[model samples]
Target: MEAEDFAGAAERKAPHGDRGGEAPRTLPREQLIGRLTQLAGVGNIEEAMRCLSEYVGASRFMLARYDLLQEQGLNFIVTSNWPFDLVRKISGVLADRYSRSTELEKCIALLQPSFEDLPPECRVPPGMSQRYCSLLFCVGRVRFALLLLFPDHMILSQERLREAALLAAYGASFVEGRSQRNDRDFELTEREVECLFWIAEGKTSDEIAVILGISRNTINNYITSVMRKTATKTRSEAIAYAVRNNLV
Candidate 1:
């Protein structure tokens, strides 16, 4: 059940549709599952991430919490092996894109994996992955991302990355209490929170008003207040703020 015990415990399936590495070092599927089942009990995120890193053949990785409303800011970065300058260069670009993306798109992309080439200034070792395989996950209303850097030119199984994403999310829950230490002084009322909850669920303002037994104008006012309190410029941004802070 200890995190240390999981190191080198999970078997890896190489890219190209076949195994080519020293297969003896890979841990079996059953053991991997059993270890994941015990993930919640493993309290240190770095140790947990290291365990996952070994399985993926990742040279390094970064686990961070993102607020889609912010142009550039991580609520907290649980752990990362990324070089400092590299993080500084990429963070703003990443946040801006996240902030600009529509709510519908953000919802659809949740827990879905993506791969992107690293910035030219950021170079990895020859055998390291040139592309970053990123995955976003949510807990309550907060969103987190795991950017795992595996080996280069090798086609990693998406199925395996998905499992790592799930496991990393579970492990990160214990880190910083999953953004619980963030600001909660928004003073959103029960009604406002209810509207935000429904809004995040894809409800139209009119639809929410009807469900909450209120006028459309009232629903609009609640959302407007939320935007003001969160310093967001739009309704979509307000909802994104709620999601980032786990308020919804």
Candidate 2:
């Protein structure tokens, strides 16, 4: 906290670095969208992100796919301007945490932007914020997370960030060459989740029928559908799947 310390910091600062005193330029959301769309059209994730970094005043960008069922990180990743060792060390933690949620939580999280802190070891330029803005989505059986780190003291409009989340989904789809990851709810129908919930509560099909004012056969059919969709052989197995996936 000495005056010399502040002077020393200024001496070390480079022009237009992530934390340099000079402010980064901001763009209109419409213009940003148009540019990202054009950049993404080239079918290059890195290229789109290179432009994104300049706009967001961030040092890096990363897209990670997480497998919620397996509790592991998928092989898919696109990053710019990040250290290799840092990515390797923290990618798993980042992926796991973002992808870890119940079916209900996933349902509510759609397109909702949020922030999280990185590990202390993940270095940025002096005074750059260590926070990451995350946007999560799902495709078929896979879940994808887009992360961006903004420079310290720079104010980014949340409106633009939300649009960035949606556009990032498109960019990811373009890069992965597959559209639709089976939808964010994993294609689980409402009645199916209801059945899964009741079963997880130790309810027998007959009891559920009485509570739901449906025939026993209909309740059995719902349970059957849940098992088939989840690929579980037994009611207990199906319920376990639901619980593990945070569905119930």
Candidate 3:
């Protein structure tokens, strides 16, 4: 899908007014933090995301792997309440944006909320905004993005959005950490996981070496180590294992 396709689709979804519904209630920062902390303690990532989304006045939420957006299928999605069709329609645009960005640009986008207009073909729930918000965060070597759909004419709080992103990251880290503990025998070093992430992005060893500023041979060695540790026969199988285990 070309970038122009997204622009044309989004243009048609714009121009809705607020329907005078009661505003979403806002929680005090301290209380919000406390609630999020409790959710994180129990590894309830879905609830944590929902709480944050509501607090920030969004009607829906989608948590996805930023590094795996380019991959086909919804396997990269961790959790979401978005319409399945909407997700499928916009995934290509999101992947295009991710691929065009440099590593430094992506790192700079961490925890920063960005809004994008929904495509025309997407039928958002009544009273919802045509635009959606997204923010990125890292949990270990893996990066995740939280996408939100809000109401029309609602002004979202930037501070709360940043806080929500951080809290979401904390919750995700807690869950990912617990999962990793259960697979301690198959643990890969941080470098190996980094390599896995790039390979999953469809980069060759030489390209990954350039991106990481390391030797191609070193990159290959890392992949070799990852394969051995995961007991996978090929790079494709290793990447599959990483995705299944949420190691990337």
Candidate 4:
């Protein structure tokens, strides 16, 4: 490394044209990694939604979990933004329409973002307004959609859009992984999940027996089986797992 060589290299450095004479703002790769890993550690849907809303500088975000089938299809769980009734109404309409778009369908299939021009055929319901949006990404098993909303004509930077789409993928991964964990978190049968749901609401085994129309001994046996299957030594631990896994 000669000093002249170093001087020539420095001379070759171009002015940052995009920054108006200032240095270009940069996020450290390590910082991005930490942010991503933090998102990955997110335990469930709500936390994932909160992280994404904050990350993308959005007023709110919507996470709609669906199951795509031919008939009686598209069951949804929408979190974030709008009243419950609004979410329900809007989702019911949008799921079928959005799923039918060749572009949106392709985006979901590829797990990629597809930017759409707005006032799209997938129109926003009465209360929402946006001129454009990116489909972001979807996770198939959960059949989740990540839609970002902003004021009309607010152009999203390519870099930011890429970051948001990447974040959506991570969000989807965390959600899917947590659901899989919940599926395995209990060794309990459907009956046991029902029992735990009631017990977590402060019902006793006797109360649960009455609710399920089973005998007290049968209820006890179910509880024991639940504890064994969930690998929880006590009711408290089982409940803790339920709470942690969002099963209740």
Q: Give the top-scoring candidate (TM-score).
A: 3
Model 4 pairs in collision: none
Cα error of candidate 1 at position 75, Å = 4.5
Q: Whole-model lDDT for model 1 versus the true structure?
A: 0.66
The true-versus-predicted C-alpha distance at residue 46 of model 3, in Å, is: 1.4
lDDT of 4 at 206: 92
Worst 10 residues of 4 by lDDT: 8-17
Clashes of each: 2, 5, 0, 0
Cα lDDT of all candidates, in order?
0.66, 0.62, 0.79, 0.53
Model 1 regions lying over 4 Å from their true place: 1-20, 23-26, 33-42, 68-76, 174-191, 194-217, 220-248
**Compared with the true structure, what per-residue lDDT tens digits does model 2 show for residues 1-248?**
32222112222333223344675665655776677777767776787766655665566777765443233343445455666665665676664554466657866766666676778877765656676667677543346666676666545545455566677776666655533243333877887788777776557888888878999999889888777777789987886676455565
Tens digits of lDDT, candidate 1, 56-165: 55667887766543433544566788777777766876776776778678778776667777777886756775567677887656677777776544445556666777
Reference-based lDDT, residue 143, model 1: 73
Candidate 2: segments with Cα more than 4 A from true spot: 1-23, 26-31, 68-74, 98-100, 139-142, 177-248
In angstroms, how far off is 91's CA in candidate 2?
2.2
Candidate 4 lDDT, 90-177, residue by residue in tens: 5545655655656435445444434433433444544344333344454532345565554332223444445666666765676556
